[model samples]
Structure formats: structure tokens, C-alpha cells
Target: MSKTFKFFIPCDKAHIVCDKAQYREASLWEKAKLITHLAFCKICRKYTKNNTKLTDKIKESQIQCLDRKDKAAMKKDFEKALKDYSN
Candidate 1:
């Protein structure tokens, strides 16, 4: 929620990397954030692989995640977590 890190994380598409070289295999920070987000945000976890398209399961899960309400807020949290991971 800090203005400094606001742009780093979009409301969605955080799984989409802005720079592939920035994290490579991902640092511990990245991994930890990803893991934590995975626990809460199932859609991001299902679509963790950035190079590939979202899987059917992921799409379905994302739809389900959307259905649960808080769709926008969850996505924002997921993006912020991804930004924390990447940064």
C-alpha cells in the first residue's frame, strides 16, 4: 500500500515479469513471497509458470477465485506479493 511500491505491483498480472533477468530462478525473498501468496491466492499459484499460458486448471481456479468475491482485492494482494517477491 505504500506509494513507493505501488507501481511495482499491478492489481493483476504480477505473475507477468517485467524483467526476466531480474530474478532468474527467483531469490529466497521471491520464493517466500510466492509461497505465501500461493497459500492464499490459488490462481497465482496455479499460473506460477510465467513462460507458459495459464493452464485450464488455473483459468478455472481463477474463475472460482473471482466467484468468491473480493476478486479485485485478492488480485491486488497477489500482485503486491509478487512485487515483493520480485523486488
Candidate 2:
């Protein structure tokens, strides 16, 4: 692809670029192309909008998770319980 026309990517390629942009992994040129594609494609625009909303929701959710230490403790307890039951 020519350097000047690199920003005219297809819908599928645009979606991939959009995802990379969401993850902060896309290059500047890729982001430009995705934006351009979104401008002309309503479906891709909607897709991008929904994707952004989903990412925001995930970030804003008050979900908690176990740390590595907690996970290790639970694993040890489970293993000990299994061993005791087997005996």
C-alpha cells in the first residue's frame, strides 16, 4: 500500500485497528486509518462506539479479584483437603 493511501483500509482491517487502538497498541497511522474508516462506515462507527462503551463499563465496574497470594493459599487449602479426603 502506498504511504499516502495507507489510511484507506477495509472494514475488517479497520476493526482490527480499532481493537488495537482500544488496547493502546495501535500505531498513529493505524489509528488515523481507523478513524477515517469509521467516518465513512456506519456499521464500523457503531461497532467502535459499542466497543468503547464496553471497555468503559469494564473499567468502571466495581469488581474485585484475588491476589496471587490469596490464590496460592486457596490452592494449598484445596490440595490439602483433597489429600485428606483421599485417605
Question: Which candidate comes out best when scored by TM-score?
Answer: 2
- Candidate number of the best lDDT: 2
Q: What is the C-alpha lDDT profile of model 2 across 1-87, one tens digit per residue?
A: 677676589999988998999999999988988888888899999999999999999999977999999999999999999999999
Clashes of 2: 0
lDDT of 1 by residue, 1-69 (tens): 685453333315346431221336555555445555556665665556442443445656756324545
Candidate 1 TM-score, true structure as reference: 0.32
lDDT of 2 at 57: 97
| Cα lDDT listed for each candidate | 0.53, 0.91
Q: How far does residue 8 in candidate 2 sit from its true spot (Å)?
A: 1.5
Models 1 onward score TM values of 0.32, 0.72
